[model samples]
Every structure is written in structure tokens, then in C-alpha cells.
Target: MRPRFITLEGVDGAGKSTHLGFIRATLLTLGIDACFTREPGGTRLGERLRELLLAVETEVSLETETLLMFAARQQHLAEVIRPALVAGRWVVSDRFTDATFAYQGGGRGVANARIAVLEDWVQQGLQPDLTLLFDVPTEVAAQRMAATRELDRFEREEGDFHRRVRAAYLARAADNPRFYVLDSTRSIADIQSDIAQRLAQLAEQP
Candidate 1:
């Protein structure tokens, strides 16, 4: 099978993180070489930027924040994602450009056109072969997040902000044939079953 690029996306607490291990294990079990990584922290420079971006006390202008995201992504693609795919490993990322569109464009009111310009410059024509969107109600997502861990700056945003993010994600999913939206409100086993099927199909793809 040709190496594939996959990205997992969701609003905070939509349970995307909970399923990463399952996806990795399932791929390994299927004998597919896969590398799992996350955006904004896949490279050393990106990790430093991620720390600053996630710090609750840190404040940044909307445009600066969006630019920073793309900067990190540029480095990530060079140092992690592209190399993995070139080496015949399926590359799975925790989040990608979709998160930028959702958080900056939808949640923070940055224009989509501005984001698209950055996306084009940084990614060129590269795009995920598959995007797994784990979707859930904002209320349920917030509740799940609160029960699990202390909130980060982004996760601590108000309900309305999160709602916009969710809507933005669904909007992107609707327009993209590469996306597979998963209802994360289901049981873990059920979700993983669905994920396994998706990975199997990818493996079988010519």
C-alpha cells in the first residue's frame, strides 16, 4: 500500500485523543507502517511554539496567532510529516490545518481567505488522504473535558466559542470528500470499530 496521510480532528473533549492509541495499534496490527504525530509539537521548534500558544497567560493578536500556527506547521511538514510519508510510513496527525480554520477562522473570527493563503503557502498541494473528524455536542464535549483534566487556554473558552469551532469543523467536513465524521458520543468500542474499518480500507487502497 502507498503511504497515506491521515489527520484526526475534533473540538476539545470530543474524545479524539482517547482513540489515538487504538488507531496506531490497529494499523500496526494490520502490518501497515504508521507514524503518529501531532501538529504544533511534532518538531522541536514547533513544540516551543506550542508551549507559548497553550499557556493560559499568554496573549497574542489573532493574526499573529494564526501565522504562528502555520509557521509551526511548516516546520512540522519538513521535519516530520513529509519525511514519514516519503519513507513509506502512513502518517497520522492529531490535528492539521483544519484546526486552524476552526479555531482561528470560526472561533476567533479570522477570515477564511487569510487562512487559505497561509495554507497554500505552507502546504503547497499536500493534503491528508483521510481525515477522521470525531464530532460531539459542545455541551457533551465540555463536560467530558472537565471530567478528564484541567482545561488549557483553548479548552477554557466559553461555550459559544466552542460551538463555532464545532460548526466550523462540520462545515469543513461537509465540503470535503476525504473527511469521515465520527459521532464520538458512541461507546469507545463502537468508535474504534469504525476507525479500524477506515484504516483497513486505506491499507487496501491501490
Candidate 2:
């Protein structure tokens, strides 16, 4: 099997973090050398930016946030993701460019065209081979997020913001062939089962 980049995306508390291990184990069982990483913190410089970005006390402009995101992404791609793929390992990332489209583009009202230009400049032709999008109702996601340790800047946004983010995510999924949208309202076992089936199908592909 060719080394492939996979990303798991969703609104916060949609349960993507919970299933990452299962996804990795399943990939390993399929004989893939899978390695897991996350956006905004995959590299050293990225990790520092991650703290600044997520801090509730920090206020950032939309353009500043978007630029910082791509800056971290450039470092992540060069220092972590690309090297892992080059070493014949499958890369599984928690979030990627799609989150930018949703968070900055939808939630923050940044223009999509602006993000597109940055994406082209930073990522060039690189894109995830598969993207698993965990979908959930806004209320459900909010309820789950309420129990988390602390709300980050993005997580502290109001209901209207989250709705826009979800819409943006779905819109992007609709336009992309590599995305698999999973309804997170289902049981975890059922979700994993479906993911397993998808993995099997992917494994059979050339």
C-alpha cells in the first residue's frame, strides 16, 4: 500500500479524539505503518503557536490567526508530515486545512478566496488522501464540550458560530471526493465498525 495522508476533522467534542486510537490500530492491522499527529502543534514552532492560538486570554485578528495557522502548517509539513510520508509511514492528522476553511472562513468570516491563496502557497499540491469528517448536531457537540477541562478561544464561540462552522465543513465535504462524513450521534461501536469497513475498502484500492 502506498503511504497516504489521512485527516480526521469535526467540530470540537464531536468525538474524533476518542476514535483516533481505534483508527490507528485498524490501520496497523491492515499492515500500514501509521503515525498520528495534530495540527497547530505537530512541530516545535507549531506547538508554541498552538498555545498562543488556543489561549482564551489571547485576542487575534482573523488575518493574523489565518496567517499564523499557515505558518505553523508550513513548519509541520516540512518538519513532521512530509518526512513521515517519505519514510513510508501513513500520516493521520487530527485536523488540517479544512479546519481553516471552517474556523477562519466560516466562524470568523474570513474570505474563502484569501484562505485558498494561502493554501496554494503553503501546501502547494499536498492534500490528504482521505478525510474522516465526524458530524454531530450543534447541541450535542456543545453538551459534550461543556464537560471538557477548559474552553479554548474557538470553543468559547456562540451557537451561531458553531452552526456556521458545521455548514462550512459539510459544504467542503460535498465538494471533495476524499471526505467521509460520519454521523457522530451513532454509538461509538457502530461508528468504528463503519470506519473499519471504509478502511477495508481503502486497503483494497490500488
Candidate 3:
């Protein structure tokens, strides 16, 4: 099969970071040339933008926040993701446009239509071939985040915000054939094993 664009997504504390590393390592073991990157920080400019987005002390309007995310996304796509895919390398991203939809649209109450407009303008219809959604209960996510030392701007939001984010992710997964929802509450070994199996199937596809 040709190289594919793969994305991993979830609300904060869903264990996406741990599994992202696993997926990258497994792809290497399988001898696939994969370029691993993360949203809001794939390029130098994107990384700077990530800092602004995540800073707890920084206050930004909802529209500004959403637009900044897309700005970083546009830069990431132009500089990293698209080049890797065009060069016949699989691109595995930590998050993508789906995140904007969930966090901004669902959690922050931005209209889906506005986000759709920006998605069209920035991505020009590009989308991941496969998306792995790490699904954990909102309560479980809350506990996980609470255990962490410092919460980012998004993480500082109340429970209702996270609930909406999770709901939005699940609703999108339901509508998209390319989405694979994984139970993140499972043991790490078990979850990684399942993810490896899924990757194996993808490798086998014609």
C-alpha cells in the first residue's frame, strides 16, 4: 500500500502521548518509513504558536485561539506533513484538524461552519487516511489530569468542557469510516498490542 496519513486524537489525559511513541516505534520495527509529528508544534513557527496556545497566563479570544491553531496547522502541513507524504513516507500526527473541531467547536461553542471554512482554506481538503481515537471516560481523564503537575489552558477547563470534547470526538468517529476508537482505560501493554495489530492490518491492505 502507498504511504498513508495517520492521526491520533483524544481529549487531554487520554494517553495519546504514550501511544504515539509506541505507534512510531512499531512502524519502525515494521520497516515502514514514517514521519511522526504533532499538531501545533511540528515546525519552529508551530512550536512557538503551541506555547502561546497552551500558556495558562495568556488570555486569547475564542476566535483568536481557533485561528492561531489553524495558522500553526497550515505551517505544519506546508513544512512537514505534506512533504513527508509526498516523499512516500507515512505521516503519523499526534493530532490534526479533528482536534480543532472538538476543542473549539464542541468545548468552546464555536460554530462548526466557521471551523469548516477555515479547514477548507488551510487544509485544502487534505485529511488523514486513518485516525486512532483514544477513548477514555471523562471522569477517568479528570483523575489523570489531576495527577499531573501542571495543567495547560485547555486542561484547566471544567468537567463539562471535557465532556463535550469527548462527545464531539466520538460523534466524529461514528460518522467516519477511517476512525478506529481504542479504549484508553485498558492496560498500556494491551492497548499497544491492539494498536500494533491495527497497524499490521493497515500494512496488509492493498
Best by lDDT: 1
Please give the lDDT score at residue 106 for candidate 1.
98
Off by over 4 Å in 1: none
Per-residue lDDT value at 203 in model 3: 85
Candidate 2 residue lDDT tens string, 101-200: 9999999999999999999999988999999999998899999999875789889999999999999999999999999999999999999999999988
Looking at candidate 1, the ten consecutive residues that score lowest on lDDT are 32-41
**The CA-based lDDT of model 3 is what?**
0.93
Cα TM-score of candidate 2: 0.98
lDDT of 3 by residue, 1-206 (tens): 58899999999999999877788889988889799899889999999999999999989999999999999999999999989988899999999999999999999999999999999999898999899999999899989988975899999999999999999999999999999999999999999998999999898887
Candidate 1, clashing residue pairs?
none
TM-score of each: 0.98, 0.98, 0.97
Q: lDDT by residue for model 1 over 68-102, one digit each (tens)? A: 99999999999999999889888999999999999
For each candidate in the order shown, give its overall lDDT on alpha carbons: 0.94, 0.93, 0.93
The ten-residue window of minimal lDDT in model 2 covers: 145-154
Highest TM-score scorer: 1
Q: What residue runs in model 2 are displaced by over 4 Å at the alpha carbon?
A: none
Candidate 3: 10-residue stretch with minimal lDDT: 17-26
